[model samples]
Structures are given as C-alpha cells and as structure tokens.
Target: MKQPPAVKRLFGLYFHHFPFVMLTTTEAVFLHTSILIFAMFIAYGIYSYLPATIMFSISRASYYLFGESNTLGANTLQY
Candidate 1:
C-alpha cells in the first residue's frame, strides 16, 4: 500500500533533517551524561566549566536553530 502525499512529505523532511536531528539527539544525550559526570567531579571538589558551558551552549544553539524563538513559551534565552 502506498502512503499519502503528506506522509511522504513528512518522511522526506525526516530524511533531510536526519543529520541535524541525530546530532541534536546526541548532544542532548551527552549533555545529560556530562551533567552526571560533572556533578560527581564537583562532589570530588573539581572545578571546571567545560561540561556545563559546552552543554548549555549546545542546548541554546539547538533551541534557536529549532525555531524555538518564534514559538510560544520559549525560554527567551535565544539570541
């Protein structure tokens, strides 16, 4: 059975944006992982900004790139 035009379009978009989506998903996963690692390091009295800053920047960048700026209820940290 053939899919409808809308479904095809959606699939096309998914394929077109798959690279970016995958990167974003990886960044999100890494962000959480880093948070846990950083928290542990902090508990051990380690001082560093690499994990927090990198993850925060990536999230902010992704938010802007994903059209969160024009969407309702955006965090407003996009600039």
Candidate 2:
C-alpha cells in the first residue's frame, strides 16, 4: 500500500533531519506531535509578548525625541 502525499511529505520533513533509521509509526507520530506542540508554545510566547515590547520601545523613543516637557505651542506642527 502507498502512503498518501501528505503522509509522505510529513515523513520527508521529519525524517530528513535525522540519520537514516527505522522508526515505528507510533514513534514517528509521537515525535511529530512533540515538535508541533513545542512550535506552538514558541509561537504563542511571541504573540503574547511582541505587542507589549513594541509599545514600550515606541514610548521610550517618543519620550527621548519629544523631551520631558511638551513645550511646543498649539500652532507648532509635529513631524
């Protein structure tokens, strides 16, 4: 019996990184699942933290550029 294209692709992606070795279907599935879970955790961490990091950087930059006081008059044009 032939494997489906998706299964073949998954094996190709996960197997190529290791030395040529035999793996039972269960072991392969477990390895793939572990890798996927790890990837999701990393992605979630970035998603949760990136926005706050960007906002902090922006505010810090603005404070340095605009100085401690808002001395500009209402007529002053901000670039």
Best by TM-score: 2
The TM-score measured for candidate 1 stands at: 0.27
lDDT of 1 by residue, 1-79 (tens): 9999999999899567645455687786786688789889887663466677777777788778885653444645556
Model 1 error, position 55 (Å): 0.4
lDDT against the true structure, per candidate, is: 0.71, 0.78
Model 2: lowest-lDDT 10 consecutive positions: 68-77
Q: At residue 73, give the lDDT of candidate 1.
A: 48
Local accuracy of candidate 2 as per-residue lDDT tens digits, 1-79: 9999999999898678764367777887787789899999999999999998997777677768986444324357679
Candidate 2 regions with alpha-carbon error over 4 angstroms:
1-14, 19-21, 69-79
lDDT of 1 at 14: 58
TM-score of each model, in listed order? 0.27, 0.65
